[model samples]
Target: MKSRLNVVFTCFLLLPSMVFAEAQSRPRAVDDFFANREILATVYFTVGSAQLNRAGEQVLDKLVPEIEQLDPDVHLVRIEGVHPRKDHDRMTELAMLRAKTILEYLHHRLTVPVDLTLTGSSPSPEVRRAGRSQHRADIVVYDNLFDPHTADTNEALSR
Candidate 1:
């Protein structure tokens, strides 16, 4: 009876800590960028041009209200330029510009300032073969303001 009483007491002590740990605000899957990010829009650009075309603007126009609905302080934004690597230098330069252009567009449109990260990378071989899919900017949003994959989270997890 004493051993059983000790077991119940130990469980009572452990339960609250487990509940609090489960309530941690950090994203459940820290390293999963695709799982963590909310894809707001995938706007495409003309070949060699970072400028927003008619369809791009229309897509962005639809995006504005959705973004405005979120509190800028709690949400994070990122623009990823999906340019597949080519033998020439133009694609790299063009990709970064495409990401920046989308961010700039967001900066001008959002009523409140949003935390934005601009990134550009060559798409995977599969995406590279998708033709028009390469010259694109993906607008991603996250509920967490800071990056979950940052060293801060990794360090905490290690402990």
Candidate 2:
């Protein structure tokens, strides 16, 4: 009876700490970027144009209201841009322009300030073939304020 009582006491003592640790370890809500929460619009550019054509503008218009509806406490935003394997110069210029253009659109239309992140990389250093054209202009719209694949998150958490 004493041993059983001790086991119950131990579990009782540990339960709250276990619950606290689990709560802390669980991923934050902003990490739900993969689940497509905060990012409302993702615009992929053609070869050399940052100009939002009719379709792009239409997407932005729809996204603006959705973004505004999020809770005020959510302040994270991520904007990533990818480069094409061919015609590097044209795509690089367009990607950079697209990143800036996205930020501007969010600010002007959504009336919300967001922390922005930008990533630029070629589809491949050496162009292979025509099979991977869509990979050329890969852009992601996510709400994660930090890159989960990098050390930045650990460093930030430590601080």
Candidate 3:
């Protein structure tokens, strides 16, 4: 009877540590908090002209309202331009122009200030062979919901 009582006491003492070990092994709530959500929109331009075609205007018209409806968690917007030819200087200039035009359009529509990244032309043959698809700009939005420092503090408080 004394040995059985000792076993029970030992298990009672170890139970909390076992529970804590299990909790430590599991993923933190903060790890699942922030998610990367993206919305992609492409605007195609003429071969050599930086002018926005009718289709491009239509794309922006549809895209602006959708972007405006995005959650506050969205923090970044990346605009990448892909050109047909491999002339670095010309492609870079055109890419900047395309990104700037789209930025101006979005700036007027969105209330939140977004972090923007502009990437120059992609030198891939696949993009070039896609015909009209080559002269295009791609806009991507990223959602970042949680701040790590804040999450850490909250976790400590919960403990």
Which candidate leads in TM-score? 1
My TM-score estimates for the predictions, one after another, are 0.65, 0.49, 0.57
lDDT of 1 by residue, 15-56 (tens): 433444565554544434335677889998887789999898
Please provide, for model 2 over 112-144, each residue's C-alpha lDDT reduced to its tens digit, 9 standing for 90 to 100: 654454443444333445444432222344443
Score residue 58 of candidate 3 by CA lDDT: 81
Assess candidate 1 and give its TM-score to the true structure. 0.65
Off by over 4 Å in 1: 1-30, 72-74, 86-88, 129-132, 143-159
Number of the candidate with higher TM-score, 1 or 3: 1
Sort all candidates by lDDT, best to worst. Answer: 1, 3, 2
Candidate 3 per-residue C-alpha lDDT over 28-93 given as tens digits, one digit per residue, 9 for 90 to 100: 543333135354798888776677778887888787766666554435566766666644557656
**In model 3, which runs have C-alpha deviations exceeding 4 angstroms?**
1-39, 111-115, 123-132, 143-159
Which stretch of 10 consecutive residues in model 3 shows the poorest summed lDDT? 28-37
Pairs of colliding residues, candidate 2: none
TM-score of candidate 3 to 2 decimals: 0.57
After aligning candidate 3 to the native by TM-score, how far in Å is the CA of 143 from where it should be?
Answer: 4.1
